[model samples]
Structures are given as C-alpha cells and as structure tokens.
Target chain A: EPEVTQTPSHQVTQMGQEVILRCVPISNHLYFYWYRQILGQKVEFLVSFYNNEISEKSEIFDDQFSVERPDGSNFTLKIRSTKLEDSAMYFCASSDQYNQPQHFGDGTRLSIL
Target chain B: EDKVVQSPLSLVVHEGDTVTLNCSYEVTNFRSLLWYKQEKKAPTFLFMLTSSGIEKKSGRLSSILDKKELFSILNITATQTGDSAVYLCAVYISSGSARQLTFGSGTQLTVLP
Candidate 1:
C-alpha cells in the first residue's frame, strides 16, 4: 500500500536555528496535515494544507510555523526559530478526501538543544 | 473546546487475551471517528467509522461508533505480543468547507507472552 514518507527520520538542531521537516505525501492525496507529540503527550494538530494554502491551524501553530507544498508531492513544515519546547515527534499525514482516513508517515523526531 | 477522552490509560494483558479501549468526544461538528496504532513512531491508521451503530472490522480488531452518545470503542481479541502499542482515537470535525481532527491521549496496551 502507498504510504506517506518523511525525510530526516531524526534531527538535532540548535535552539535558535531554523528547521525544515519534509514529507512526501501519497501521490493522489489532496489534503495534507502536520501534527506533533511531545514525549509522552497526546498528539496535537498543527496545520492543514490544501490547494497550496493553509486550510486550518491550531493556536499552537503560531508565527514561527509555516507549511508549504513546494511541489506536487512534497509538503514541508518550517519552524523559523526553534525553542526547547518545540522538540517533539513531528508527523505528516495525507488524505485523498476531506473526511477520509489519513495515512501518516513514520515521523521526524526533532531534538533542540 | 473540542476534546477526545480515552479511558483506562494503560493496560497489561497476556497473549490470547481480549481487550477493549474506549473513547468519547465532545465537538461541534462530528464527521468521523478513527482508530490508530502507534509503536515507536507515527500512528498507523486502523479504522474509520462515520455512521453510528455500524461496526467496521479488520482481522482481530473491530470498532464501532455511537454518534448519539458521542463515543466509540476498539476491541482486540486473541492478542499477541506484537499488539503492544498505543491505541489512539481521533475525531474529525467538519464545519462549512473546513475540517480538522482532535486526538485523545491514547491507551497504552502491553501484551506479554
């Protein structure tokens, strides 16, 4: 079965540096989403992208976060300035339709120090 | 505020035992309920139910949604050690042309030999 895939399975970055987490959604998917989970915490929604624009975002998705669909299959989340609290497992998910089940990537573990 | 609550945060069982995980949600617009299995990385989709009282099943796992009560349950029978993982329940909210998902803290299931 086709699945969402993310690059840089794990990343370590300085506290003030910028980080980009990349994802290649399923080829035919139309909606993409980003979610994060702090260690031992519930997964939280960050943002959703469709038609090259952000469709929805959570309060946690503040000024530092941005999402881009630079290409047909690539969906990326960029954090302008990382904070220690930003360290978490970032996941990418995609769905073919609005209300369908989303398929998720293995996730990129972001570690800030 | 939208919320998903899962009961009995952690469970331990032996192989061949059966287990049930519960999830309840309070949201503005309910679209669907989903179940996922997480083991060390991203969550893998297991089931999605849109209508109430209709059960969806795959292998030894089955789920049913109760729209009237705003709850759902996931059952696993004859479990194996490989079944040890965090089971997450998420609800999709639809409003106008937009949709978002809220996830629960998840139930951690440990199946021992």
Candidate 2:
C-alpha cells in the first residue's frame, strides 16, 4: 500500500519568513492537491495540480502561495511570507484519475511565531 | 458557495456499540463523496461513494450515499477503542472549473471500553 509522504512533520517559522512544505505523492498518480485545516476547522482545499500546471485554486491561495513539481517525485507548497493565520496542518493528496479517491499524506503542521 | 455539513460534532460510545455519522452537502456538479478517518494528524481514506443506494463497506465500517437527497451516512458497528477518531466527509465537485473537495467539519467519535 503505497502512501503519500510529507517531510518536516512540524515546521516553525517567524511570521514574515518564507516556508516551504514538501510532499512526495504516490509515484503513479497524476493529480496532486494541497489542503489545510485550522486547529478546529474543516479541511479546506487550497490548490490542485495536473499536467505540470495549477488546475484549480481557492481564494485562500493568494499570491503568497505557490506549488511546484520541481522533480518527478516532489510536490511542494511555498509561502512567500508567512502570516499567523497561515498556521495549520497542511496536507498533500493525490489521485490516479479524475473522480478517483484522493489519498492523503500524514500532513505537515506549520506553526508561525 | 459549496458547503458540506456534518451533524453531531462529538459522540461517545462504549465497546460493542454501533454508531452512525451523517453528512449533507450542497455543491454544483457533484461527482463523488468520500469518507476519511482522522486519528491524529493525517487522514486515511475509508470509502468513496459515487452512486446512490449502493453501499461501500470495509470490515465493520460501511458508507452509503444518497445523491437525490444530497446526503451520506457512515456507520460503524461493534465499535472499539481503535475506532475513536474524527470522521470526515468530503464532496468532490467539478462544475466548470477543475475538481476539488469541500469537507465537512467532521464528527469526533470516542469509544470507551
């Protein structure tokens, strides 16, 4: 059972610093996604990537956020300037095809100071 | 805005008891509904229901979707301490843009011995 893997299980950074969350989605999957959850809130979709471009993004995914598949295996989310409200558990997910069940990673807990 | 609502924010039950969690959603171009189990940081896929009436089951857990009514239910029978976790329901919808997920707040279930 191959699963998505995320690096730096916990990240702590200054409010104005930049942060990058890394994920290695399942090798054969084509669609990748990023989602976040505030401490007590529902999981919110931020962005989705396919064919080497952003397929969709939410309003929360503003200019501060960017995603890339820098390599064949790594998918990363970079925040140019972190904010206190950006502190949350960021999750990476992938699916084999359209409408397929998306598998998720353990998540990286981002904490802004 | 697409929304997913889950009922009963929290629940507690004893061993061998049965419990059911409910999820309702209002989204355009509904594609599929998914159930996930979140024990701590990461969420694991449980079931994906694409059609109405047909049930998707794994062990003591089963889920069914009602597309006509715009709701879904997850049932866990003979609950154990291991079943104590937050259950999340997310709807996958693609109206005009790319597909994305809309998650409910989730139901926290605690099973005691």
DockQ of 1: 0.82
lDDT for each residue of candidate 2 in B7-68, tens digit (9 for 90 to 100): 88999999999999999999988899999999987889999999999998999999999999
DockQ per candidate: 0.82, 0.79
- Candidate 2 regions exceeding 4 Å error are none
For A7-43, candidate 2 gives per-residue lDDT tens digits of 9999999999999999999999999999999998989
TM-score of 1: 0.98
In candidate 2, the residue pairs with backbone N, CA or C atoms under 3 Å apart (3 or more residues apart, or in different chains) clash, namely none
What docking grade applies to model 2? medium
Q: TM-score of chain A, model 2?
A: 0.99
Residue B52 shift from truth in candidate 1, angstroms: 0.9
Residues A62-100, model 1: lDDT tens digits? 999999988777999999999999999999999998888
Q: What is candidate 1's lDDT per residue for B17-100, written digit by digit as tens?
A: 999999999998888999999998879999999999999999999999999999999999999999999999999987666577
